[model samples]
Target chain A: MSKESIILLLFIMVLFIIGGCQTQELNESGVVAGLGIDLEEEELQVSMQMARPALPGQSSGSEPAFEVVSAKGRSLSEGLRKITLLFPRNPLVAQANLLVIGEELAKTDLALIADSILRNPSIRKNAVVVVAREVSPKDVLNTQVAMESLSATAIPRMLRNQERQMGIYQEVSLEEFLNKLARPGVDPTAPAVTLIDSINGKAIRLEGTAVFKGREMAGYLDSRESRGLRFLNPGRIQGGLINIPAPFEGPGRVGIEIIRSQTKVEAANTDGQIVMRITYIGEGNYYEQTGEADILRLENIPVLESICAEQIKSDMQACIKQAQKLKSDIFGWGNIVYSQHPAVWAELGPDWEEIFPGVKTEIKVEFELRRTYVTDQSLHYQ
Target chain B: MLGSCYDLHEINDAAIAQNFSLDLLENGQVAFLAQTTQPVPRSETGETQPSQNISVMGTGRTAAEAARGMFLHFSRLFLWIHANTLFIGENLARQDLTLISDFLMRNRNLRFQTCVYLVCGVSIQDIHKAMNERGFAITSARGITQQIETQAEELGYYTPLANIELLERMLTPGIEPALPQLTVIKEGDKDRIVLQGMGVIKNNRLIGKLNPEQSQGYYYLQSKKKQGGLISIAWSDSPNAMAVMHCTQFTSNTRPFIQEGKLNMKIDIKCELQYLETIGDDNIYVPANQQRLEYLAEEKIKQQVRSCIIQAQQLNSDILGWGLTTARYQPGWWEDMAAQWDQVFPVVGSQVEVECILCSDGLSRESFRFN
Candidate 1:
């Protein structure tokens, strides 16, 4: 062929390659932003959140912006294969923001779902995992809140908000979970999620925590119990409220908002007996009350402090009781014993279960009521 | 390059995933869930854009196969570069984290800093749906971690651990790793996610945890420098009076030594605090009050640091990196104690010295005594 003819052929070939590349773009792939898993009849029920992008101020037809596709199979891998039967486009999972599992699955075997995730070149390892409160994993994928277009992202966003704002729960990524599960001294816990119907629309909420005894679901911690544990755990707390009966006898309860708080739990091993001493120091003010309490008087300050201290101690004790009842070391007493007294751990490590329940625990709480939020006496009494 | 390279993937042919989760099903299958955003074409007059986020889930005995399964029977490719948080169900975490870590580490799209968590009580699917609604999806990057980070700064305890850091600690000897655990709480009208505590790890099995106070001490000992957090101290001159000290700057230096053939460590710390509130109607700025506050804070800090050391010794997990410290500062001693470090660590004595400075008295010197 002539030189000119060869050049024309090369140019045409390049154009063809570029056209091939254009076709390879994301044209046919269904972007999967979230995944849900449920155990039904000994089968794996897999759910996917498919995103349908809308134009910036354009009118897209009556088609829903996103679609949820689910499939069931003998195994999770089989479920994925079955999902393809429902989805016309290739399902993309790299950016999956949220992972939801049905309660039954959580109780059955949570480990089976994580097999070979580390080997998947396309999966992001940072996606957060949550437990279903009462809803099925497939249905959870279909629900969405008002502010967010995708419940996958919205759910995590809300969870992060709760963790940050209330210090209720932090991000529980796969790596963190695995680390906890593989460790001996600490049991793993994840945020529990529930579906709620609000006036705004369908919304998903992170209700509390699911406590795990080894690999199986053992129990759960309520908000109050979670809060009590939060105060005992060392982290920055934005604030929390506690309601107590009026320092003086009255028909109303007083609410105190703890603006700042700190707690310390120390383990003391003496002779053959091990005891844990918990001390909580807090600073706050009387937020609201229905009855009158004179907090401004120097004498009354002690009364207020005592009442607040009593309430805090109770909160801490309640959490401890739950942990003990479940026989799950959610508070990490095992870790405390392992770190503080290695010799004791050596003897008790194998038989920690029996010793954990009878372990001695004491609680002490102190509060500094700063300003009474304007008046020392309740408005009702005034 | 928008459809530029002949060998590259085309944008229109794939979807960008925002979130991903993996759970263990009863059938020993790996459940993989991915959240993605699908873009819609704009009309001549742009108006009325609807929802565009979706979730896709699949299961495989292994992760790679399941991902390939997601790509099967579909026209477009699944792009995972934008995926954020990843979660492993509770059962999977206990079974084998190394397996999942290996799979995730191999992924080019999985960033070293990506946030990872273990789902305990709830399933991974519930976490995905807890917030996604109306087509709006929140990726792992912009999730609740931001809130935890902010509060972590203000509280100066229980900081979030990243994937890379966690993996390193899990492998590194002389130190165990800690992870931020999360839980769900149902409020009056809605459910909320909350921080449970630090999941303390040792011997690669879920064992126990560090309660807030113990966690605070753990962080305090581990922190190279402290910025801001509150400390409550017993106020001066009164048994019932208490004072809150809002700390600002914290500097610490620890020195390890072998005295009389016994391992010993001493920590010297300097901290500054501003008076936040006083429980009693007393002048905290006075000379006597100032001395009392300083003493109280100092004593509390010293005890806290010492307690944290004891906790580390008990768990047989040196989360404070004492082994690392001795290795860096006292290499010779560390070398001799390296084999016996685990045994010696629990016996090693720690002495904490704290000096607290009351930087400010707030807006007033005296309590609300207008007389």
Candidate 2:
């Protein structure tokens, strides 16, 4: 053959090779919707939840669904490999909406668990991190959702709701918790989740929060205190209120909540005292109505003011008391002291826990009930 | 082309051989006047222009000796800047005349820079005047103060999310109480000596000036408990007033080990005065019901304050001065205390007591009963 013909033959071969690789299915795969991490006693537990595609024009509806697979090994990567054995096709990459940690495993040791998270490149740092407070994380992941096609998509929407609400329940991003674990002054807190079983069977429930001081389970802030505990950073929340029945109207009570808060802390003497204040503005909606007094009466305003003050005082005290009991300055008090009165904090030395319980508090709260939300003093009066 | 090449070599040789001369301002110190980033036309000789604005702090005997302290201080600041590079660049890249006052307090070596402190020492009016003279718009820069937001995406430490606002990271303190850990108390009366350094901050700066009376007020404000014979005054009550003006109804339960059902918190509190202003006939008279109100306010105040303190404990927020209290009371407590403080605070068993002192409401308490 002539040299020109040989060159043309090579070009034709190149076209044939390119054509062989042109199908869209060969390049793109699938997306994962949810992930579950469990500790299998002696080995690592890993699970993946993916949204399966629906059949077109089938006799039955395509109703959204997902398949659950389990893998176990000494390490997360190895566990993933074991799980892959159960699937025919490769797991497609998609938005991972939720990550669930089993209660039994979460309580055992978090350091290794966190390491697995750090190593997984597919795992998103901001994926909702929840610890199964009572039920197994795998069980929580298994629950079916009626609204959404897949539980993977449904679970995250639930967590995101809580995130938008009061924002005290920290989202516990993998990166943030890890950063906090490494810092001495700062500690980590994760949302506690549980599977609740009613007459209808199991459902997901947000328990409260798990406080971690230095990568160890320090303690927990119950639901009420957790509401206030979450106020420490506010994270993504704009502002929220904790409705405590205000002591204004007789019988029925008004709902009072803090609309905004600001905190300042400092140390005075070397290792001596740290003074902090949660300066907040309280706003509320009236849940109670009484006929004897007008809600708009200026004289009644004092009653409303006192109710607001007491509520704030209670919230602030609950936060402090919890910090003292847990011995973990999860509120970043150590950082406050160090930043404000480093000299004094230094004198106290390394053991800040001992120095924390005896600490005194100076709290100041300001309240403004923007509106009564209604004009009528009472349902009976109206 | 040959001639040009020969000339280029001569120029390079001359630049390498010539010794740079300098006449630095010698004020017996090392002043690091930041070189303006603007480029200046080289003198006909193409020599670099000298700056006369750098004023660095120095503690050494010689100019070179002083350079070490200045450099050390700057090094610390540089590290902070490096750690928060993105935050700084996003927030303060445009702001001129950076004041390093609070920064100096943390690093005492920069005490000489106090005169240059801007946010606190200089009044807003003064700042306005200076800015006018400098031909800079007050609201020109887009700072966090202007952009109120809730969500912030992390773009390597600094997000466009309000770095100049709530989390501006200003290297100074603000108007609220400094962190009350190290209080400087001076003994005096009506025209009193100021007590500084509670370390309370507002807007990222320290405003540490508390009079003895205000200190007592601060204590009362935190405690929510009234002490015997301590007078409080509230002139006109408004909902928007600071905590200093509001009355509080304090409640608490101090039973030991009450974590389960019917967990009782020994609670008591009633509305009591939080502020005072000595005025004419419309004023709250100190002697009117002094004896009776004093007794009532004591327990009530204590309960209110304790509730606040306890709530901080419950949330593990540490809003109270417990760390300092422990540090002062039990300095070596952390050796064993640190391990248990978190668990101990929420369940600390103690006697709960409260009382409500009724001050003659200028508006009159009888008004509530009649209305």
Q: Which numbered prediction scores highest in DockQ against the true structure?
A: 1
Number of the top candidate by TM-score? 1
B1-371: candidate 2 lDDT, tens digit per residue: 66434212222111110000011123322222211111123554555443111112323222212222222111111111111101111011112112121122222222221111112222222222222222212121111222111111110011121112212223211101122211112234211111121222322233233323333323443332222223333333433321122343323322222435212233333335433333334323346544444454454345435654454444443323343344444456534554555565555443445555444344533212211
Local accuracy of candidate 1 as per-residue lDDT tens digits, B1-371: 75444336557646677767776678876677776665655556654355455565555555544443343112245677666566666666655454354346445556777666655567766655554443544423245566566656677556577777666676566666766666566677555556666766664544556666676666566554335667887764678777887777777777787789887788888888888887776656566677778888889877777766777688777777677788888888888778877688788888888899998877877666636
In angstroms, the error of model 1 at B364 is 3.8
Range of the 10 consecutive residues with the lowest summed lDDT in candidate 1 chain B:
B67-76
lDDT of 1 at A106: 81
Best model per lDDT: 1
Task: For residues A1-382, write the lDDT of model 2, one tens digit per residue.
Answer: 9999999999999999898773436224445677777777777787777666644322123333676777778876787667668776566533676777766566667776677677777777777677767676667667754323556655555444343333345456667767777776767677776655421235555667787656667666776677667654522233343443435444333333333445444444523456565555445443223122334455676677766666666766786688678777777777777777777668664887777777776666656655443233322110
Question: Residue A370 in model 1: shift from native, Å?
Answer: 67
Collision count for each candidate, in order: 155, 96
- The list of candidate 2 runs beyond 4 A from truth reads A1-30, A55-64, A92-94, A163-168, A198-200, A234-236, A239-241, A246-249, A257-271, A282-296, A342-349, A374-376, B1-371
Q: What is the RMSD of candidate 1?
A: 27.1
Residue B96 Cα positional deviation in candidate 2, in Å, after optimal superposition: 65
Candidate 2, lDDT over the whole model: 0.44
